[model samples]
Target: MINPALQPLSDYTFARLARMLDGIAPAAGKRPILLSVGEPQIQPPAFAAEAIAAGSHLWNKYPPPKGDAAFLGAVTDWLTTRYGLPAGMLDTERHVTSISGTREALYQLGFLAVPERKNGRQPVILMPNPLYHSYRGAAMLGRAEPVYMNATPENGFLPALDEVAPEILERTALCFLCTPTNPQGRVASLDYLKRAIELAREYDFMLAVDECYAEIYRGVPPAGGLQAAAALGGSLKNIVVLHSLSKRSSGPGLRSGFMAGDPELVGRYAEYIMFGSASTPLPIQHAATALWKDEAHVESNRAHYAENWRIATQVLGNKKGYHEAEAGFFVCMPADDAEALTKQIWREQAVKIVPVGLMAREDAEGVNPGDPYVRIALVYDAETTEEGLRRIAPYF
Candidate 1:
């Protein structure tokens, strides 16, 4: 067998889920509840179906690698409107490119950023400790040292700029920042983002901001990368923001997203994809364009997630770490030990939740930042989440 490190990291999250539920048959007496994966249970917008159906003829032809003109323009318009970027902030001819979804684009970026060395030393890829798994995989595939910055509670669950020690930034090749961060459901404020962008420019490393969860906030709209770019003199020079229709439109199956950044990098990534990536299928592109043009459906999807969070806080309100999720769908609640609680919940209540450790890794520091907390993705509807919490409160 090949070395395990050569295998994909994503498989670990699910494989652990499988083992946790091993040989455990679901109780026929009660329906099983899943609060593990982030896949949204809400119905996707109707426009997606309509758009894809209208573009049925395009299915017969191979999608052009760079994306169709309409798709590209819809993408640029979205960047402008959502982040309030000035006109021409992103020149589509050089600045924008499409991917099947964020995963591939994000992972591929490691290959684009990491070089053999910086000052004759192995380049580093900076990532928040409890980060999206793809970011780590990107660093490994790029052959750069994956430097983990603890995004634990003390840091507001946000990576700290001042704490990045000057040495790491100097040797850094790329830094991945996921706002409205996964599991934690924390958003990096605008000041935080601007500071990170400034650090990236000073260190001369790429700033990759994963804003896939940008559309699902609770109270205030999120401060996105494009907004940060506008503040940083309206340039997409050191920034790369990745957005997807999956979370934005609850259309993960469509597998559509785009990246806007330094035109040189975007063009390079698109070129790299041309030889390897099956371009976002034209039908999917059409659906995505329609999604970008219409915000009504996104508002509805956002409401569903917001409702689920409200239901979560109502049930688990008094429990430790139960602040209403500010953004994204996951809730991070204090647990004695995530692995133990995960199994206990499945065996006793038949409710499936992922251990926070599965979503994070232990660095040389011997601390998995997300440990002692289980990540509950409120992926179901109001009723289902309420029931899951009702059963969950007992175990915690």
Candidate 2:
């Protein structure tokens, strides 16, 4: 039998988008410009391909279960340089594990972190509303109660940690906090991250900070979870960070990323990977190593996304309830009925955008925090993104 825990969750964001527009065709003669998904349309660096091809000879061999040492070392160095962590704070051997992508790593973590019971009751997994759907899947499959911490306009679209009751914290087995959060691009402050880290430690639960979009920002780079740990007496206990080359290096097809944090937690996660996980292919590891070691392409990606946001602002800055994205490549546009707005945009402009509610579920009060907005991805080239935005601008 299928896992019963999957019953309550809604269809995933993309799948729902497809079903919503299934029988309806876009406006006649207007080619569909898909702004619904967050996949980047830009080409990754040429060097990534070269590196992969160079390692073609190793294609026949399976990747090391722990990780290729060079790949892990490159990731360690990138984490240190990007987050300003002290040298040697993260041992390449004890504190890192290779994965196919953060989505897989984050979901697999549920198996390693969630227990059958906590405090003699079913455990809870806390995730922000308007979440990355994987978190809820992880919680459900792990047989934990999935609690939604709503991030609404009233709180600057960041989950209010202070408001979670002490009882919920007591039973939490895992908590996922996405920086430069998807759908709503809000970055957590250093203090905010530390408070989360502190709570994770106090509650004896794992705090998984999804930093997949961490590298795609303009102005000051967002603070990382490890940076918060560095300030908190240099301890990584109860904190694990999930990062992906998908956003950072525009290499989602490469399917490589890593988890870094508390040695004990990493040790257990690596052990699980040895037998159960799909080891990242050896060729992809070589490509990831090159991507992590280089920053120029990442900077170029930032500039391109910055231009997309700028175009969005130019088109809809003064439109009612439009907030320029704080970071990352998506902007959530407020609407009276986001689902209706999504259909209207597709029918009239032939431009596709996702209703934010589809990515979120109603909380305890029967309110979905994402109900008021539609999420548009600015992942296309600026010119194409601008064209798509102009087509949908009138609706807002």
Candidate 3:
């Protein structure tokens, strides 16, 4: 029998989307363009394949839960340079461990941080309303109350810290913050991140930052949780920042990334994975190390996304609700009715876009902040992206 705790996670975003468009076929003679999911269409660099091939001889041996020293060192070195942390601020063995992807680590954080009770009450996990689905599922499965903080245009698409009740903060076990947030594409500033860290410390909860999209931005590099900690006197406590090569190197298939911060938390997570999670293969780890060392491919990937944004603006600039995404590949725009519009675009134009309502939780008044918007992923090649935008523009 299934566990009762899983009841709250019945409808995943993509599954719900598929059900919504089930029997309806796309418009006649037009190719279906799927912008519903944020999978990058670009090919990963050739070096990834070469690295994997070179390390393939070790496939017979079981992979290690905590990756090899080379992989760990590569990740730590990259983090130090990326966040501008002090040279010796992070110890390879003490501060970092590799995960298959940030998604796995993000979900595991709930189990890693939640307790039987906090401050004599059920523990709470706070996340933005239009959050990554894994965050909510993680909280429910871990038996923690998932608190939805509404993030809307009024709040610059970031959750407002002041709105959280004092009581919720008191029992909070973990807080999930996504920078270059999914669907919204809003990046959290250094000061904003510092404040969240401060709250987590004050309330004695874990702050898990999902920064998978850290490498895909339009302007200045987004500030990270580790960077904020360095600014706050260089201590890694009550905090864990996750990074992934999925977005950075356009290698989601690689499924390689790491969680770094709070030596205690990282250590516990490594222990948990040792017993419960699958180890990342040795070959994959080798490929990931090569990826972390190279920035040229990443720069090229960013340029492609930048051009996609330019194309979006040129095509839909006059639309009333269109706003250029600050970072990440998705464009979240207001709609008369997100679900209905999503269906209309699918049926009439053969273009698939995600309804933000599917991702957001309802507010106290039962109003979903994302009910009026649709999120479209601009992850295709320039020609494909331009065509998709052209098809979607008419509906707006």
lDDT score at residue 379, model 1, on the 0-100 scale: 80
* Highest-lDDT candidate: 3
Ranking by TM-score: 3, 2, 1
Q: Rate the local accuracy (lDDT) of all candidates.
A: 0.84, 0.89, 0.90
Candidate 3, residues 276-367, lDDT tens digits: the string is 99868999999999999999999999999999999999998899988887789998888988888888888899999999999988977898
Query: Model 1, range 1-396, lDDT digits (tens) per residue?
Result: 766665656455777679767887765577889888899888787878988999999888988777888999999998898888898887877888888889988888888877889767889999887777889889878888888888777888887778888987889989999988887878888888999889988889999999999999877899998798798798777888999988988888888999888887888887787677779889889988888999898888888887887787778888766777678888888887788888878877878888888777787778888787888888887888898889888776
Q: How accurate is candidate 1 locally (lDDT)?
A: 0.84
Model 1 alpha-carbon drift over 4 Å, by segment: 1-5, 8-11
lDDT of 3 at 178: 91
lDDT at 274 for candidate 3? 73
TM-score for candidate 2, please give it.
0.98
Error of 2 at 38 (Å): 0.2
lDDT rank, highest first?
3, 2, 1
The residue ranges of model 2 lying beyond 4 angstroms of the native Cα positions read 8-10
* Tens-digit lDDT track of model 2 for 113-147: 99999999999999999998789888867888989
Return the lDDT, model 3, position 149: 90
